[model samples]
Target: MYRYDDYDQRLVDERVAQFRDQTRRYLAGELSEDEFRPLRLQNGLYVQRHAPMLRIAVPYGLFSSAQLRTLADIARRYDRGYGHFTTRQNIQFNWPELAKVPEILAQLATVQMHAIQTSGNCIRNITSDAFAGVAADELIDPRPWCEILRQWSSFHPEFAHLPRKFKFAVNGAKEDRAVIQAHDIGLDVVKNDAGEIGFRVLVGGGLGRTPIIGEEIAAFVPWQHIVTYCESILRVYNLHGRRDNKYKARIKILVKALGIEEFRRQVEAEWAFHKNGPSTLTEAEVARVAAHFVDPAYESLPATDAGYASLLDENKPFAAWVKRNVRAHKVPGYASVTISLKKTGVPPGDITESQMELVADLADAYSYGEVRATHQQNLVLADVRQSDLFKVWQSLRDAGLATPNIGLLTDIISCPGGDYCALANAKSIPIANAIQERFDNLDYLYDIGEIELNISGCMNACGHHHVGHIGVLGVDKNGEEWYQVTIGGDQGNKAAIGKVIGPSFAAAEMPDVVTHLIETYIANRHEDERFVDTVRRIGIEPFKAHVYGNRQTEKKVAHA
Candidate 1:
């Protein structure tokens, strides 16, 4: 709910005008594709297979009802009446005409939103936990820090064009919902023994070709110096990160080339110069930013609502939905509800124009007029009152957004692969749909427990396949599409990249392969064990054998 002031409004307006002029020049043949590539990419415009894709940044995944309506309008007028929510909490319009992008950006500016830094080799949107301020286990509201970074990084000339793109995530809760360890820079808000607030910084973590978990660069950076510490890390990376080869350009490669100790030393040396400089945040500034993220007007109510309890007792469907889509809130009378966008037949994260308006209306009526997008490509009503849970669920169910499969196997994270992205070797949406159809049974999915199945068209890892419990990567085998599988990846504080499990299979063979993997997990699991936990404990060999040993069985399962 941060409102833009005159300065913020001016900046966005000027950016829109600037891009409009650039677009005009490009259209008039004054700039070649090579010349305009970086310019357009910096504004979040990518030329996909069929058309130009525009990624709109939703900072920290927060949106007001008005902004949601604006997005819906843009989708209906400028796009194909739908938008794809991404793992970074951004939204993508897959079929926007390159000529009309500036017009679309002008519309976005009216709502205080823009696509700046959503793409290209600059710091992208600063993300945080979807339940940042309201979660039961939150240590602090990370939205303030996320906003602070967004301000600091937006159009910052020093880091505008680095070796490669950069990402930053903040985890303010005990649960690592932000998946900080998978970002270029990760921050965990912490309180020291003396009760002073600070941050634990993790640097050089990414998930592309050479996936590596970040290392702790600073154990404790005081709140006032958080910006200074981040600046130091970015400065070190800007100067030392590889630039010759695009594949090795990320900061992770630089950190690997220089050991963590050396990287830490370099960052420390850089930090000493600006630790107490003008960039160091003051208490007043911190308070000013934090004020925007304060708790909503909560009513005085008992810890348990009678009506909510009665619904849980009486309605099995509602109970199941609460079990999966609802999360505990810090406030006793409130809950956070995840509106799943991954319906069985629909492409994961794709939301139609009508659905966006519906969510906006629901947010206004039930969630304090605000919505938060999760890194899992879903939307969150972060402050829903427990008393209104059934009503909110009913509205969401009517919109086909109440899938009740949060954290389940069918809640897949995927990218627009060969279907839209020219860089993709195989189609990701079809694979996700196939898997979702195969695992459509909610009861069976709940029994199977929490499983992250991510698919990417290529190794760009846009779908974060490397971090999923069940990771699928599409590869180009000769001229055909082959899918490779990986397991045991996790994206929490203890992040780990998955390992390849032998030869790749044809596209039609993926569902059966995934089923066998699930069957193997069920066979090997202990009481109430998660798929990832089981994989970590038992290793990938058992699942691999089950998938590869019985081709006839896999064929039968695939046909079924």
Candidate 2:
């Protein structure tokens, strides 16, 4: 993890004091709600359905054990005894008293954390693959690049208030775990055929009401110009993006209206001014950032540990956990372990204060005092030794964090929705809970195989429903909640937006509708085919036919 220097600490400390005084003024009647709106939003405070919610940014999802312990303490003392980790790799604490939020921010500052630019119309968090450095298939480490961007974008004067919020995701692995194609600016750190490092830039990718898969703006940009190129794209968006309607304000809408070629041309024109200017990075700058993310002290051991093998052969539960929640590490005897926050009773990505402390303790005990919040709404110990795998599994199982459902149907990604977010049209937590309850059987989940089912309270797509293999979106009809289904959406290199199956269904029908989609997939898929692959092969028609039987289809048509 990157430790804050004097300047970083001074900036954050000053911001906390500024917000504290602003909050006091608001409470003292010196500022009205309208006057304080931007003030609070810039500090990551939102007026939600029942109370204020505070979102804390975790840069590239990386945090130290000490930082985790501080977060746990803040949740325990200031708000409820829990917090929700989000798809953007941040955490939100619902039910924080408005007046107490400044105190929370001050506490976060002590651990080199803050909420600046987490909300309002500005560049949001910079995210990347959780297993950046250690993944077996990784080509480059994205942490340094993500950190450089994080520093560049925070409180940037020119982009302080763009048309809407912006996002960036960097991927350096063969597998796109960061889901770069779903971000406003997706950077794939790559090496050209001539063996020089650069970025494959994809601009205007986003998911909301109008989902879009980003088009390539530049096939390759040299490493020195990454920041300058990003600034160029944002400059174009700020100059031309719509401001009349909030729904049409994202960069994706502007890119679509102009077409990819025209969009690229505009970006190129803007980039020419700063291509090799002062913003261009030097070798020393990259190396300085990269030093913070170097490998931990790993032991030299055999690739396959005998104790790990014995446990896998003897214990069924342990073997199942290892199969689902563990991943290959680049080192010979090391592996990354994902602690499934998708346990049966727990909401996806929701961790209690006690559970947060447990993760901290385990990070210190097994990993190298580091943990990552994953895009799947899970927590990962990215450098656990293969020999210590059984002990890690036992501790997690006892804590109820080990559900052995990593890529299975039960590991859902969802948002707070109507439960907390005022912007949500319907509730998302209940639908996610219903689906988890419906698919509680581990054997059944394994049979279903690796599938992503995402639920969003509204089309803002906080849950990233547009990229799920099975997406459930909430809609409002006559002031009542209804759920819509989309299939064949996927992330990774072959990213695509999901298409709606048919008319929306009542909330009560969602669980069974999902069941029907799975059944249709089982009936049609060839041997060893995944759910998304099956949907792409057979199309959405079969799933729709199976979900909406003939008479129901007619009723749905009439309703539509």
Candidate 3:
């Protein structure tokens, strides 16, 4: 985990003091709503349907147990005793009083955390793999690179206000846990044929309104020049990206308007300005940043623990939970455990204050006092000892954090839709709950196998619905809530945007539609094929035939 130094601490402290006065001025009517809007957004405060929603940045989804405790305390004192983890790997408090946000931010600063750049048109939180450094298949630790970008982008005046909000995701593992292709800028840390460390850059990748898979802008940019390459891409987008229509303002639209070749040419031309300039990273700079994310003090132990093996044989429940929740760690005798927040009937990603405290306690006791928030809205203890697996599972089960469904259909990623966000067209939590209930049977879900179901209130793609194996987007149809369904969307290196089946459906028809889609997949799938795999293999037509034909079959749906 990265610790904030004096400079970092001072930066956050000053922001808190500055925002306090800004909030005071707004409340005193010295600043109008228009004047206060950007100021509040820059501080991660949004006036929602019910109250102000405060988003706290958890850089690269990494935070300390002490920070977690502070978050829990803030939720208990100022919020409704719960916080929502988002797909960007940040947490949101939906009911914070606008007047009290500065106080909350001040408390966050004490623990080296802040809400800066969590919202607004600036670069949002930098996301990475939950298993970044510790994953068995990792090529290099991405946390350092993520941290480097975090430092470079925060409060950078040049990119303070782009055509629209920007996002960056970094991945270094064989598996693309960071979903790089769905971001404005995606960096894959790779080694070239000559065995030199470099970055494979993907620009103009995003989801919302128009969902497009990213193109490979640069095959292998040397690691030292990644920052400059990213700056080049952003510079191109900042200059030419549409600003008049908010809907067409994204970099993705610009990339589509100008072909990928032209976009790459423009970026390459821009890169020449600072290709190996002072901004280029040096070995010392890399080491200085990486020192913060080195491997934890580990012990020599056997590959498998005796008690853990016995428990796997003795308890079927524990074994099932382990199969879904536990991932292999690079270090022997250690494991990464994902505490699923997608429990059935619970709002996906909502963690209560007590639950947050429980996770912090578990991290201290088992994972070296560090916890990683996942882009899927889950919490991870990345360094749990194999021998202590059962105890960790027991503690989590008691806390209602162990749902034993991590990548299953019931493990949904959703946003706080009509209930909290004023930008939402429909309620997302209810749709997620309905789908979770529809596939509540554990054995059935296990059989269905690795699938992503994402729901969003609107097209901002907060839930990343466009990349889910099964995606549900809420639409507003004549003041009523309707649902739009897309299938075959997959993330990772071979990322692909899902295809819309036909027209949208009423909210009541969503569960049935999902059920039929599942049935269709089961009927057509080959051995060991996942839902997304089956969708890709057989295409969306068969699933569409079953869902629309039987449910309304003739492609019946409502408004766009």
lDDT of 3: 0.92
Q: In model 3, what lDDT does residue 236 have?
A: 94
TM-score of each: 0.98, 0.98, 0.98
| Candidate 3 off by > 4 Å | 552-560
Q: What tens digits encode model 3's per-residue C-alpha lDDT throughout 1-560? A: 78888998999899999999999999999999999999999999998999999999999999999999999999999999999999999999999988899999999998899999988888999999999889999998899999999999999999999999999999999999999998899999999999999999888789988887787899999989999889989999999988899999989899989999999999999999989887799999989999999888999989999999999999999999999999999998999999999989899999999999999999999999999999999999999999999999999999898999999999899999999999999999989998888888999988888989899999988888999899999999999999899998888867888889989998888889999998999999999998888888888899999987787543455421
List, residue by residue over 496-531, the lDDT tens digit for candidate 2.
999999999888788788888989999998999999
Worst 10 residues of 3 by lDDT: 551-560
Local accuracy of candidate 1 as per-residue lDDT tens digits, 120-217: 99999999999988999988788898999899899999999988999999998888999899889999999999999999999989997888898888
The runs of at least 3 residues in candidate 1 whose Cα sits more than 4 Å from the true structure, single-residue gaps closed, are 552-560
Q: How many residue pairs clash in each candidate?
A: 0, 0, 2
